[model samples]
Target: MPVWRRYLVRDASGRMVELPSRALDKAEDGTSPIPGFAGRCVDVVAAVLVAERGQSPQVAEVSFTKLYFDKSGFVDTGKRERMIRLMLESVADKRLARIPNAARAEAAVRAGAARLQLADEFAWQPGPAEMNEVMLRLDHRPAGQGHTVH
Candidate 1:
């Protein structure tokens, strides 16, 4: 199996499938009805981040591959999406900001995921009221600790 195949997850019907190109196009072009990232389709994007932005491959793989497996060691797409949204909501901006254009890339990932309907995950953007809270939280964290938040 290819490295990317390791990131595939089974849906509610126990069906595991690759992300189709049409869905990818829809996500990339902003034609989808929702605004979120597809959890299972992020392997390529993660690879690109590592290749272009100097992000560590091991770091990217470890951070993303966790989304595909369940507590029982089975492939599960069910809650993987929730994890993705939580990652975005909690610390993605601060944690990934050092990587240039990381935010936009991540947003696109989320949008594409949403478009594919592979997972129910949605992208999160802090509102005006929440921005201050988010900034405050980020301001308190130390830098370059070399720990993956999610």
Candidate 2:
């Protein structure tokens, strides 16, 4: 008799059967939802952001893939997004003023695993309370483009 034994598991229907590790990995309890960059939330966030900006969807997908999709299935999209927002600076009036230590400050807030609240009108604009202290400058749409703030 062979010394090695076949491993078996019970299915949801209460049936005992032998399955490969790959199948086991796909089981309800075996898989855990990935958070951030490459997860479901990232797709939603990217989709909303691109659409709101009237950006090309193809470019948005390619950009998302390039930034988050690597060999592994893990990325912290929250901190990445927050850092990008925090690093935003104004480039208007021929002057540039960056947020002071934006990365460190945002990182402290984005360290935990919290679910992002998505909605029809989801917007993530980082800025100062006073209008004059705005760190970033947005470009005006071309003439007749009819740009509307969401």
Candidate 3:
């Protein structure tokens, strides 16, 4: 027995495009260019639903962290400080708890920097990050028309 499902998504010009089952069923989000971060951050989500390799979910977080925080093994010293500052500002503008699981990687960078900083390079453990993900699920409701009582 075979079950066939068709996914139709609106494309860039506000037109609906039929998506192949291969794109929908893949583990990847179908829009991510870097293949990590769970496809939740605005930067990553710009593409939306990217394909995923075998990389772990944390690859984007750690990769960007390293790029921003670490010297990157080069003498240039990189944009670490500026990146950290932007993160601090972004967190201030956005509420971490409100960002949702669909965008975990971006939310963490923007809101969870402090936590991620503590985790740092090679020191990050999945426990706290995982806990936060679970918490994001709280108070969730299916998106649709709203009902109001006067």
Candidate that would win on TM-score: 1
Model 2, total clashes: 2
Could you tell me the lDDT of residue 60 within candidate 3?
Answer: 14
On residues 1-150, what C-alpha lDDT tens digit does candidate 2 reach at each position?
A: 111212232234533334343432332132532222233222211111123444422111101111232223343445446444433321121122354566545543443212122111122432233111111112222334322232
| C-alpha-based local distance difference test score of model 2 | 0.28
Which residue runs does candidate 2 get wrong by more than 4 Å? 1-66, 76-150
TM-score of each: 0.22, 0.17, 0.20
Lowest summed lDDT window (length 10), candidate 2: 57-66
Order of the predicted models by TM-score, top scorer first: 1, 3, 2
Assess the local accuracy of residue 112 in candidate 2 as a C-alpha lDDT between 0 and 100.
23
The whole-model C-alpha lDDT of candidate 3 against the native structure comes to 0.33
| lDDT at 105, model 1 | 79
Ranking by lDDT: 1, 3, 2
> Which residue pairs show backbone clashes in model 3?
29-49, 29-50, 30-49, 30-50, 31-48, 31-49, 31-50, 32-50, 40-103
lDDT of each: 0.37, 0.28, 0.33
